[model samples]
Target chain A: MAGDGRDERAWVRGAQAGSASDLEALFRAHWARAYRAAYLVVHDAAGAEDVAQEAFLAAVRALDRFDGRRPFGPWLHRIVVNRAIDWARARALRREVLAEAAVSAVPAPDDPPDAAAPSAGILEALASLSPEHRAVIVLRYFLEHTPGEIARMLELPRGTVNSRLRRGLDALADVVEQDGEG
Target chain B: MTDLRTELEFAPLPGEIEAQQRAWRVVEAAYREREQLPRRRRSLRPVLAFAVAAAVAAAALSPPGRSVGGWIQDRVAGEPDAEPALVRLPAPGMLLVAAERGPWIIRSDGSKRYLGDYEDASFSPQGRFVVGTAGRRVTALEPDGDPRWSLARPGPVADARWAPSPGFRVAYREGDTLRVVAGDGTGDHLLARGVAPVAPAWLPREGRTVLAYARADGTVVAVDVDSGARLLRTPRARRVREVFWTHEGLVAVRTQRELRLHDRRGRLLRAPAAAVRRELVAAVPLPGAWIMYAEYDRRTNETQLVREACFGRGPCIAIGPSRFFRGAGRLRDLTLSPDRRWVVAGWPDADQLLFLRLPSVGKVVATEDVRREFDPGGSGGGAFPRLAGWCCARASG
Candidate 1:
């Protein structure tokens, strides 16, 4: 994590100066983690890609303004999380507009995500949690960020992060247990 | 314990990491391209101002000679580029896009001949005719793209809706009053006045229209249009949430924790405490006793649809997990088909649009092309409900 952060910072500085290669290097380095964070939160591959890309783009755009003192993962997570929120809000607005348009019955489902192969039921169970809880799980377990780092990234009290993590775990367990019922 | 923590420690979700890296490459390349440019001494304020001015101007000008139908065809041609302006609904074959700038149309077929645009586009219970707006301007054209009417009124158009018959209505807000106009922009009447209404929803099979307004206390008041009578005044649930009226009942996301449903008479419906919930994406009323609500399940990383009671007789029916377009994607802009059998979700960041079949809400029925129209900052058109459709009376003869 330390090496990744330091290397990412170097790339960030170069990208801020508009170095394409540096930006590419940074993308190669952090895209997997960023995408995983977004995918775990959104569970939609298309959306995950966009979120990950947006997070990187935001990092590059705001790189000049970046304090450079903090870890890059937290900063990037903040961007990805914020973009995800915006995506959620936009989705809600579109739904409202559609409802107003007088559509009856449920619309069809979305296309399935092209996962490498479906992960274990844990992935499915993970999908059952709320976005807030999912975020905590992703940050703590997936991204391996500390509760304090998550607090700083999400702008919440450390306690809130801990609670979200605890609740997320509980919820995940419940979903997995329920799945096992069948 | 299988150690969910161990699961997280595992490498990224398989191929997802590669896909994201590819996407990142695009953004990085684009940014690097931006950097190499001569440092623009000019601030972006002027460019933004110009763009805004252009959009305003575009809103002002009408699409020439093109009927609402033809305009739809022209826009459909631009779909391959991920056009932000054009969107196809999830039905077997339907497209909802800005055909000619202002008039949004729902096309049954890809052709413009099957297209209809509303002056004020509000869909009916079944996604029928493009319901015309009241008091506002309508760009009506013949099948050949000949302009038949460009109707504008003196007062601001408040709202518009289609009656069960071919008849439609539009309500316009003129100062403190509301002016209701028929679907064709004729037979104008003052449905209600002095209420200063915001969202006016028409009840099924009745002349009754419900007008919701913000009270001084920040609560919302649902008033009847016919009697100018206040039905139920409830505390404002969420400052930025949408309310729906259906034959089954009235449903809205009062808050993330509360899904409120009421009958036509405003009776209370069941409220469920969800363990994990994404924001309410969209709700589609079904033919019989169903209304499917789309939600992004942040927990499972899946988009979910829950079917609930419209008759106040039953609880929500889980339509089961839905499939999303991008592998491990997030839900963006989504639209449900009129039958509630299909859902279309958009992800602009990946420049992809998806249409999925619902109830058995799995499997992709159609995947179409999309073109990016505008770029404000990162993506001017990330998934917002840019897609819409309505049911209006079409001559069955």
Candidate 2:
């Protein structure tokens, strides 16, 4: 995962003992994936930053009590995805409130999120699915968590995770005609 | 389905690097504040025990109730890597400190000179001089502790704030009355009677002599000291403790319960919504249109610092309530350096003075045994010192 993740345990031990450099190494290793996974689910730049930052802060706070033997990635990813889903759900409710306020609250049609990029086509399609469905898809494909792991991370039934993954994939299957890189 | 990980990993996000830098600093600060779980170091335990035994044996021979443990801790209270003392400031400004002895002027090089006994002190606009008040007396001294002028008032004076650029006037509280004096400590006249116990703030606009003070009735008023015209006044608010004016023409009023932003017209502007059960203790306006504040949680007993960036003058647009520093106990004296690069405050419970690097931090410098530093000879170390203000090389509005 992050440089074979062999160093993760050592970094956690060092960070728990008041080593800032070890903490930085851990943060740098996981920040990208944590941020991107949150962005894919929340679909807002600021929202993703908040989710990822909050996840990192939580990790730092729990560093003392954390068991270094356990993997840090899954723990951090669970926080990221859950917070992102919460943020997306909150934003959805805010949209409904603004919608009731006036007709002008509606945004103009966006150009596929990032029109010039070919990947935006897939992202636009993913954006259409519910945040819960997006979380399962993101955890499965993006963070590379297995169905069992996703269920545990999200505290959902494995069957529910699989159903959301299937529905999410079916939605994006047409949008992305070609896919590359494992 | 082919893995979309490759695309998701590289998708462009706006301000990613900036956000990472900002978030890393906040996370790092929280980590630094945390007391790490004691790690097993069996080899060093004996050595530490010997040292502790020696100290105890030395203390046992001393007078009853006086332990050398506190004196020892007063010498080494911070991290082993922390600088033994404040050798230099991260930013390029001078800091004014009110210690148990008196006010001390600390230059950029970290050298300090203590003025003779005074209870409180504040820096002039350009760091050219200082005005110190001690029990029925107010004295203006050069940075080198030479008296430029001294005056005896009928009542004790404190919180003397010099007006903005060209720095021609100073405002101080005499008894319950507010008064303003010329920069040379002459032409002293009463501005408002029966003012609150809060410090007065000068609106930092060039060529403008707008002075803001809270009334006894909880009304905050900004009046032109020269023309005696009311610039702005707020509806009665309770227990106004401190008033801070910004260069961007916004005044932030901090009461016991909440901190709020008011524009030049005195209309209360919407602030970043604070969560329930959190008490707002202090707020200081930064160089840009930004204000940094500390919120103390009653339930958790944690203090959190938040930074807000405001745009426009009146009916301002507040961009963020971004989290800055979170520490145990309360972080008091939220003072910003002149360059807006560092926020210096005292963490009382930790007995450490925190110098929080602004915007973001790869470097967090804290001075330990803060009380002892202010109390040299280390008898036992007085209460923590007050960070008067961080001033610039020259005066500016």
Considering every candidate listed, which one attains the maximal TM-score? 2
- Output the worst ten-in-a-row residue range by lDDT, candidate 1 chain B: B42-51
iRMS of each prediction in angstroms? 11.2, 18.2
Point out where model 2 deviates above 4 Å.
A1-182, B1-68, B71-81, B271-276, B312-321, B394-397
| lDDT (tens digit, per residue) of candidate 2 on A24-96 | 9999888888888887887766567666875776676567668888999998898788767655654554454
Candidate 2, residues B128-206: lDDT per residue as tens digits?
8899998888899987566899888988888888887888989999988999899987999898998998889888776
Reference-based TM-score of each model: 0.42, 0.55
Once fitted onto the true fold, the runs of candidate 1 whose alpha carbons sit more than 4 angstroms away are A1-182, B1-95, B98-100, B104-106, B112-120, B123-159, B172-178, B187-199, B206-235, B251-257, B274-277, B297-303, B308-340, B366-369, B373-385, B390-397
DockQ, per-model, please? Answer: 0.13, 0.10
